[model samples]
Target: MAVAIAVTRERREGETRCAVTPETVKKLIALGATVSVEAGTGLGSSIPDDDYAAAGATVRPDLATVLAGADVLLKVRGPTAAEISALKPGAVVAAMLDAYREKAGVEALKAAGATAFAMEFVPRITRAQVMDVLSSQANLAGYRAVIEAAYAYGKGFPMMMTAAGTVAPAKVFVMGVGVAGLQAIATARRLGAVVTATDVRPATKEQVESLGAKFLAVEDEEFRNAQTAGGYAKPMSAEYQAKQAVLTGEHIRKQDIVITTALIPGRAAPVLVSAEQAASMKPGSVIVDLAVEAGGNVEGSKANEVVTTAGGVQIVGWTNLPGRIAADASALYARNLVAFLGLMIKDGALAVDLDEEILKAAVVTHGGAVVHEGVKG
Candidate 1:
């Protein structure tokens, strides 16, 4: 029998992206999966029901009808409590479940007896790259951060040599040269800004320099070995952080725009920009904090709101930057879901192998219990 897969509209506020696009729906159908989509699921992404219907998915107006008896459920965000209760026992769900923070949602999935996989938990291995939602989304977030900063800044990014006079180019400083920071640097540079970036991970120096951006760091022994084997930034010592802060504080004061994208998995975002740092920035300067939702990398950043400090530094902390560019974000995110779903379907039937490394890492609940080590009590 063909595996039954259902896609529903995301219920999260300000989430405009959908889990499945018509293009992915066609691919799922070709893989022998019976795809059902709730009516208007793709509306926010500008994908109408007609497109999904044309792509071989049954578009039902009622979400319950779409999910009823479904063998697998796909979502952009974690399902709500009522959505979890609607799923059949033994059914599979895959989404950006945020298992690390949404403890109640994980418990609800366990109680509902649904086998759930958190896309954010997918390992950062070569084989799992196609299924890595975090990278795909963060890549866009980085690009969007630069764009947001440019919009918020009163001056032009590129220097202008007008007949009146010469205008200097914007100076962009990116903190935490991870995927997002790298992209922000590239985007700002492409817009003709003078970009400089720093990260705890010493390995990123080459990447930053390669993008024609100046690499700034304290460059101590601790910085030499500040990355995990998985290439994640390891938390630096207090002394190292203090030294780095001094350098960043000086750098921040000179920058016209700053974009901070540092995030520690399962932990609050590290504070790279303090109130003093913001106070030192020039008036009309802008700061975009991609880590705002995770407690903010900039001191005055508020999630989903742009605030101007008393000194006139605008802090852009709008959450879900990927959703701002919904069409492309939805396309990439849906493809990620399709690739991940491929792992669990065999011979046109839902066949989850919990022993698989990707599944083992991502599966937060299975067999009526929270099974992921990080989430289990």
Candidate 2:
């Protein structure tokens, strides 16, 4: 008999992305797993019930039933407390568990006796790239951040010269040129914005300049090499950080729109922009913090809220920006989940080898305990 896999839609407020798509559902069916999905769950992503049916997935009306029978529960976000209670003991759940801050969700998974794998915790290894939810979702988030800033800014993005007047191009400053920051630079440049970006990593300078954006380099002997081999930003020394503060502070005051995307995995977002820097921006300038969910990179940033600073600059800290483009985000996220599950299912049965490198790295809670080294006590 084939293992039963349930791909339920997330019920968390403001979460619109779905973990499984009809295409992935069809693949799971081919691998000898019975696929079940909640009704209307894929609607936000423009995936209809008929699509799932056509892909060999049964659409259940109630979430409780869908979860109760699931041998494996695939989701975008971790299951809510109530939903967790209905899971079959030892059922495997793969999703963005938000293990760092959402303690309640973590506790719920332990109590419900389900093994949880956090897609966000996937190690930055070549073998895990296809299964990386953070990279897949952050790519979309970075692209959307530029679009959001463009929409919010009143002036034109590209330079405009006409018989009447010549309007200078908008200046955009992006902090933390990770996946999101790089995309923002590419998008802003395509939109004709004069882009400048800063990162602690010396390696990112080439990437930023390749996109035609000026890489804001700070003259500091302290930050000769400031990147982890895993492609993550390493915390800078206090001396280097102080120097960067003064330098970037000057650059920021002149930017028309700034987007900050610096975040440390499993930690609170580093405060890149002090309140003083935020207050110095010219009136009507905009700042979008992609790390708003983890305490923000800018001062006074509230998750999911747009607030005007004392200097009249607007700080937008809306979390889950990728969900705003739900259809495509879901499609990509579903593909990521499919790639991960592909490793877990072989020969028409569930084969969870704890020894496997990818599985070992991503599995946060197994056998009803927080087992991942990063998340474990």
Candidate 3:
């Protein structure tokens, strides 16, 4: 018999993106997998039950039945403890699985004897590019961040030389130059904003300049070698951080819009913007904090809230930036999940090899044990 793959509806408040799409349903079926999705699973992404049925997936209403019979279960967010408890002992569950923060859920998966894969742990390697959920989702989040900033700013992004009076172009400053940060810079530039970006990694300076934006950073000796081989930023010395802060602080006051996208797993997000800096910004200026859910990069920024300072500056801290573009995010995320599942599906059945490098990195719980090194205590 063919393996059963199920996609569940997200229960988290404010989570609109789904783990499956009609297009991916066909792809899953082509691999000889029997695909089943919850009745209202794709509604948030504007995909109805009829569409999933048309694509050959069984749309069931009972989530418990769908989960219990699933050989492979897919989800947008991590499965809660209650979710894992509903599945069979040997069921394979795949999702973002926020292992760093959801320690109890990881333990629950182990206790339930379910093999679980955390998409967030998908390795950033050449072979795993198709399975890289972070890149696909972050790309959309970055684009939306610039759009959100533009919406909040009172003035135009591009300069307009009118017969009455010339409108000056908005100045956009983006902190952090990761996947999200790069796309944010590109989107801001596309809107004709004079964009400037900063990052601890020296390699991104050229990338920022290529996007028609200036790169702002204190290029000290430590700055030159700030990135590790794994493409993560290394911590800088206290003196270097202070010097860089002073330099960036002066530049920030002139910015009309600022978007910060710095996040590190298992740690509080680094504070990039101070309250004083926000206060110093001119009235009508906007700040979008992409790392707000991980503890805000901007001071006084609240998750999923637009806070207006006494000076009239606005801080946007939306937790689900990619979900704002629901359709596109769902499509890309579904494709990523399909690609990951493709590796384990063989001869019209489930076949998992824990020795595989990508699987080794992404699989958090397998054979009733916490397998991933980072997540396992």
TM values, all candidates = 0.99, 0.97, 0.98
Candidate 3 per-residue C-alpha lDDT over 345-370 given as tens digits, one digit per residue, 9 for 90 to 100:
99898999888899888898888899
Query: Candidate 3 has what TM-score?
Result: 0.98
Q: Once superposed on the true structure, which residue ranges of model 2 sit more than 4 Å away at CA?
A: none
List, residue by residue over 1-377, the lDDT tens digit for candidate 1: 89999998899999999999989999998777999999989988999999999989999988899989998999999998878988999899999987888999999999989999999999999999999999999999999999899889999999889999999999999998988888999999999999999999989999999999999999989999999998899988899999999999999999999999999888889999999999999999999999998899988789999999999999999989999989999999999988988888777877788888898989999889898887886
Top-scoring candidate (lDDT) = 1
Better of 1 and 2 by lDDT: 1
Number of clashing pairs per prediction, in order = 0, 0, 0
Q: Residue by residue across 134-193, what tens digits does model 2's lDDT show?
A: 888888899899888888787899999999999999999999998889999999999999
- lDDT values, one for every candidate: 0.92, 0.88, 0.91
lDDT agreement of model 3 with the native: 0.91
Question: Where in model 1 is the C-alpha error above 4 Å?
Answer: none
Which residue pairs collide in model 3, if any? none
